[model samples]
Target: MEGQFTGADVFFVLLGAILVFAMHSGFAFLEVGTVRHKNQVNALVKILVDFAISTVVYFFFGFAIAYGTSFFVSASELSGAGSSGIFEAKGLTLVKFFFLTTFAAAIPAIISGGIAERMKFAPQCFATVALVGVLYPFFEGLMWGGNFGLQGWFESALGAPFHDFAGSIVVHGVGGWIALAAVMLLGARIGRYTKDGRPIGIPPSSVPWLALGSWLLCVGWFGFNVMTAQSLESISGLVAMNSLMAMVGGILSSLVIGRNDPGFIHNGALAGLVAVCAGSDIMHPIGSLFVGGVAGAIFIYAFNLAQNKLKIDDVLGVWPLHGLCGLWGGIAAGIFGSTALGGMGGVTFASQLVGSLMGVAYAFAGGYLVYGVLKATTGIRLSSDDERMGADLAIHKISANPDTDIMR
Candidate 1:
């Protein structure tokens, strides 16, 4: 118990924990804001349930699989230094669990928006179980464990080990890829597309929810990035500040690029946050600003194309904000990472390129396989009744409907 909660340590941790907790509300409101007015309650409930499920998974198998003794740490998982995680210290295991469970919880939060207003809570629950319980463990072990882990093949050939400072790839990337798979299988929402192939724009029910959610997310993101250092180390303070810059950079840059574009005010900030997650520890604040700026601009363009042209029906923009920005974060970590900030070992340009590819491969392959199975077996798509009724009231029978006379 003492090890679990010391006064001084708790000071920092509680602050971070509280902020992270607030992110749940942020997810709820943001998702609600992006979905159509008819589905508002559905969006909020999905966020709630995802967190609830994540909490349980975290305490049970997730913590153990991510941090505890791997039931099977392959010989390849051993260190090139001849040590395997076989003898990993108990404390390190706990530390890993702390980082991983938090990370694991975030994956489905992003996915919720993609499959919003449809999927049965049960199917979604099953997918989350597979993701956190089995799928995420494999990726987590592979990326962090390296030679003394399951992904020895990657370590043997990949340049410099897989380095995701704050899970730009692990958390955001995994979420993005899985969300994509879900969105692909689920198809577009009703009336979202035309037989003529024209796209329809369905605004979210609550703009206030979107703004508030973005604000809360911005607040929690500090913990998400700073906690990557796991302590107030020599560089923790700077990393925290760097994260701040990226968040702001994403907002300001988008405003400037869009020149007061109303459609994307909230999205720009999120893009910046995602872009900076990977290299927050190593990159200078100035570099992060530029990187985040690029991410914000790219997100605006990407989102416009998806809704306007591709007609993919990404209700809450799962692709651009999470997937696209996540891709940027991995690459930026490489480009902006300086040797001084606990980043790339050297100041060379080539290292950044390598980091980008590694992040993409790690997330895409694992994410695809996990969601793919569900798509094949359980058939991940939702029935039209669920889509029309809104998932909240339809699946769980929660009465968020505006039409309800008593609530009115």
Candidate 2:
């Protein structure tokens, strides 16, 4: 019976890993549909390659940094057959690594959208190595793995450890804020603004593809959130319900607030999901709805603010959708997850705020330092000629539709 239970746990986490892994396709299609046709191929390729890189790096380095686990052992030992006891029975640890690697890889996938058209591919790949292997795991250790006693400190000082049921701050917030630094360093895609600094509109190549990306992400998010429980015994229907309600809330608010703009409406769904991730386990369904609504609005306003007022030129508005919304998710967990707000309790607003802010600051600083150094050394942006040609031709040496280009 114990053996059967261990096998079931392995299968559960493996299924969750597979589902979250599928979200990379969602990320790819989302970027493919958002960027100009000339850059679509590059977008797809980057997501896949970045995932590969993230897998290798996390297996070798990042996972160890976070949990102090090492996979460099005999297969028997790794499978708990050799009595090392370093891993769980039935290879559960391996599947857990698979699940977490998908989360770690999401950092580069998020950054890929922001720097899409004008950044050089190699530098971005190097940035992925640094981010997944070091910067991101450093924080993951602090928050999730209880490294350096940070969560202990939070409990001691603030009456509770920071509560992120999923990776609202850890994954989405870190990725989004890091993307902000990359976008700023890469500067605006050429002609994205007029000489006088007025914004120019660049319409999406295909709205259907954009919608498909959102749909895929929305579907896979169930696994991303629910599987955080890491065991079938720990699973909660509440998490699934809150995710659905929050997604609906985001959709409705963006529909109204964004005046039915397809871009805003699609991304608003994502915004809500991103925000609710932290508190989904604890918050009431009603609180989740409001949180989702607020997140949807935050994405609309903050995207515009970053693009227009701040002139950040983040290509897919990743900073707003993930960074700011993720930050909100972290803090919202405190408010909405509190007993006062109909939550399961054991959370504090101060802890959430500090942890969320800490994530943002750390990610931004790490992003800037990594990309800034890359820019100084090998350079991050493409040449003006490549910018004009688009990333497909400039980097990958082929257009998304070569036959169509040939006809032209």
Candidate 3:
């Protein structure tokens, strides 16, 4: 019976890993559909390549930093071939690594959206390696891994530890904030603004593809949230239900608030999912709906504020969708994950607020320092001539649509 349960745990986490891994395709297609046709290929290439780099760096460094686990030992040791303890779960540790690596890789995927068109490939790759290797894992360990006793400190001070059922702040919040720093450092895409500073509109390349990306992300997110259990017995139908309620709430709110803009409608779904991730297991379905509704509205308002009012050229509004919403998710977990709010109570608002801010500050500072150094030294953007030519041709030496080649 113990052996059977251990095998089930392995299968469960492995499935979650596969599902989250598939979401990388969602990231690629979303970027592909959002950026101009001339830069679409670069969008696809960056995500896949960054993910590959993240895997190597995370395997060697990030995992150790976050979990204090190393796989440098013999295969038998890693697989627990002869052990009969927690380590003897038939190498379930390795499967857990696969699941968490997908989460780590999302940092680059999120950043890829914001700095899409103009950033150079190699510098961004370096950024990915450093981010997944150290910066992201440092925070991840603090929040999830009990590293440095941060959660213990939080609980001691605030009467409860910070509770993130999945990774609203740890993954999405960090990714979003980091992307903001990179985008600011990289600057807006050429002609995204006028000489007088009026924001120019850049239309999406393909709404159909964008919608498909949203669909894929929404589907994969169940695995992202539910699989946080990592075992069948611990999994909650509540998490799945809350995710659904929040998703639709985001959709409906964005549809209304965004005035039927297909882009907002599609991305609105993501904003809710991002928010609910923190407290999906604790909140009631109705509370999840409210959270989703607020997230959808926040995405519309914040995206506009970032792009138009702030003149930040975050192409997909990643900061608003992931960063801001993730911040809200952390805080909302405190609100909605309480006994008075029809939730399982073990959280505090002050703790959530502090933790969320800490994540944002850490991510922004790390992103700024890393990209700032690269900008001053190696240079992060394409040359003006290359920018005029588009990244697809300048970096990849190919266009998304080869039929245009014949016309040229």
Candidate 4:
């Protein structure tokens, strides 16, 4: 029985890993298409760089930190659902590499909105390093790693165990917070706001980019949420169904929230996916959709508040869509999941709130520190000249419009 369970875990892990990989292209298209034509190449560069950096950092140390049984202790004693037997083996190492690679790639863009069209490639890449190599694995072990030793606030709240089937808190929350940190450190894009504190409209360069990227993300997220369910082959049906329902819920929610906003139309479905991710495997289909609806509302509101009210420059709306909505998923997991189906404790709305908050504080604080250092040093932002001229022409010496006078 033990051996069979182990094999199933291996299968799900690999499958989930593939699902995450598919998201890179999803993010690429989404981000690039959303930005101005002048900075298209830079947007593409940011996504690719995040992907590559994660591949390297996760392979070398992030995997060991995340799945490693023992960092201070020993490899044999690390945590999470995956087998410790494969912890140090090169083959398993490769598997962990792919799983985390997608995660690492996802984090850099939280700052994307703030730095759009102006950020230098090098600093953006460096930001990826902090999130992927330093921040992610530490918390990942704390949440999902079985032998994590449970020293943090988690132990106080969770006692012997805290469940994160597909990393609503660990993966999405962490990425969201890190992205938020980057936004804060990097600051808003030029012209994002007026002197009177009103926001200026910076429309997405292409509607196709907006719609297609959103669709791609919706598709990729299935892998992100569903792969976690493969752990129980016989019961995979329920798990996958839950994930599917959550997306439907998310879509329906978009209609309600975006009643007047086209942007909401673009993100309503995504909010649903991110919302359901944490509890997809354990929740009933109804619960999944409910969570997604709630998330869509939150995503739309957060983005507006950030732009119109707080004046935070989130170019792609990454912070609200992923960060805030992901938070909804994390807490919802505790509320919606059935302990019976999930093999853990059942949901209690309140306790789940506490769990999600813990994840937010840790990720936000850790990410802020990384950004603070970068801010204090080489400075993690672009010059005003670069901002106005566009990142491609200024940084890469390539103009989006070759017909422009400077290029000619």
Candidate 5:
């Protein structure tokens, strides 16, 4: 019976890994649909390659940094034939690595959208290595892995530990803030701004593709959130319910607030999902709805602020959707996850604030440092000629579709 349960746990997490892995396709399609036709190939290639690099770096370095576990031991130890160590659960640890790795890879995937069209391929790959191998894992260790006793301190000082049912702050917030730094450092795409400080809009190439990406992500997010349980016994229907409620709230709110803008409508659902990731386990369904609605509204406002007033060309508005909304999700966990709100208690607003802010600070600093250094030495942006030609031709030497004349 014990052996059967262990096998079940392994299968559960393995499925989660597969589902999250599928989300990368969603990421690729999202970017493909968002960027212009000239750069569509680059969008597809970047997500896949970045994910590849992330897997290698995270396996060798980031996983160790976050969990203090390594796969350098013998096969016997790894398979749990030897006495239990970090490689416990009869090879389940390795599968767990696969699951967490998808989350780690998402940081680069999120950043890819913000810096798209203008970033040089090699530099972005370097940035990916640095991020997955070091920067992301540092904070990941502090929060999820309990490396430096940050959670312990939060519990002692704030009446409850910071509770992130999934990874609202850890994944989305970190990705969003990091992407913001990259976007700011890379500067706007050519013609995205005028000499007189006015902003110009870059319309998406295909709204249908964008919507497809959203649907794929929305579907896979169930695994992203629910499978944080890591075991069948630990899984909660509440988490699933909250995720659904949050997604709808985001959809409906964005429909109203964004005035039927397809872009905003699609992304608003993502905002709700990002916001609910932190508190899904604790918040009631109604609370989740409110959280999603607020997140949807936040995305509309903040995206406008970042792009228009701030003049920051965060191409996909990732900072608003993931960074700010994820931060809200973290804090919302404290408010909506309270006993008074019909949630399972054991959260404090102060702790949530502290933890969420810490994530933001770390993400911003790390992103700036990594991207800034790369910008100085390796040259992160493409040349003016390359910018004019688009990333498909400049980096990949191909367009999404060949001209009919060329084919003939």
Candidate 6:
């Protein structure tokens, strides 16, 4: 029985890792469909390469920083066969690393969407190394790994510690806020607005492709949220049901609020999923519905405000969708996870608010620091000529559809 459980845990975590890994394609396609056709190939290439870099960096440095464990030991110790006892008996620790590394890689994947079209490739890669290796893991350790006694302090002051069942704040919120800093540093894409400061409409290259990306994300998110349990015995049907309810809630709200705009409708689903990540394990399905509905509406309105009113030019609205909504998710977990709200309880509003805000502030500051340094040193944006030429051709030396260009 012990051996059976050990193997099951490994298989479960491994499967979760694969599902989350596949979501990188979702990120790539989402950016591809949102950016112009000329820059589509760059979008795809950036996501794949970012994942590769994130995996390597997180393996070498980020994991150790977050968990205070290193893989520098011999194979026997790593596989739990040695006297260290730091790892599980059946290689479960290694698979756990694979699972969490997928989560870490998501930081760069989220930023890729915001900084698309004009970012220099090498500088962005450098930024990824800094973020995944240092900044993200530091915060991750504080919240999840109990580093610096912050979680204990929160519990002492607020009567409860922060609870992010998944990574609404840790992954999405941090990613979104950091992307905000990068977007500000990069400025609006060329010609995104006129000299008079009025916004210009740059329509997506392919709506179908955009829809496909959303579909892929929605499907994979189940694995993302549910598998965070990391073991078979801890799985919950409640999380799965809440995720489904929230997804539809987002879809329905976006459909109405966005007035049938396909882009809004699809992204609405993501907004709900993002918000529900922190509370899915505890919230009732109905409560999850309201949380998701609100998140869907928030994305539509905030996205419009960011682009039209504020001139932020976050290409994919990642700030609103991930940053703001993820913040809301962290707080909502406190509200919707209460026993008074038909939830399982064990969360507090004050702690959630403080923790969520802390994540946002940290991410924004770290983003500016890292990107600011890179801006001063290596430079993060392409030159004017390169920007005009499109990243696909300028950076990769080929257009997305080469044969079609030749025929033209």
**Over the stretch 1-408, how does candidate 6's per-residue lDDT look in tens digits?**
999999999999999999999898899889999999988999999999999999999999999999998999999998889998898888899999999999999999999999999999999999999999999999999999999999999999997999998899999999999999999999999999999999999999999988889998999999999999999999999999999999999999999999999999999999999999999999999999999999999999999999999999999899999999999999999999999999999999999999999999999999999999999999999998999899999999999899999999
Report the Cα lDDT for residue 169, model 3: 96
Off by over 4 Å in 3: 83-88
lDDT of 5 by residue, 240-285 (tens): 9999999999999999999999999999999999999999999999
TM-score of each: 0.84, 0.99, 0.98, 0.85, 0.98, 0.99
What is candidate 1's lDDT per residue for 245-277, written digit by digit as tens? 887888887898878865477878888888888
What shift in Å separates residue 259 of candidate 1 from its native position after superposition?
4.1
RMSD of each: 5.6, 0.7, 1.1, 4.6, 1.1, 0.7
- What is the full ranking by lDDT, best candidate first? 6, 2, 3, 5, 4, 1
Candidate no. 4 TM-score: 0.85
Error of 5 at 171 (Å): 0.6
Separate clash counts for every candidate:
5, 0, 0, 9, 0, 0
RMSD (CA, Å), candidate 6 to true, equals: 0.7
Local distance difference test scores for all models:
0.70, 0.95, 0.94, 0.70, 0.93, 0.95
Q: Where's the lowest-lDDT run of ten residues in candidate 3? A: 80-89
Which window of 10 residues has the lowest lDDT sum in candidate 5? Answer: 81-90
Residue 330, candidate 5: Cα error in Å is: 0.4
lDDT string, candidate 2, 260-284, tens digits = 8998999999999999999999999
Model 4 lDDT on a 0 to 1 scale:
0.70
Candidate no. 2 TM-score? 0.99
Once model 3 is optimally superposed onto the true structure by TM-score, how far is the C-alpha of residue 230 displaced, in angstroms?
0.7
Say what the RMSD of model 2 is: 0.7
- Pairwise TM-score winner, candidates 1 and 6: 6
Whichever of 2 and 4 has more lDDT, that candidate is: 2
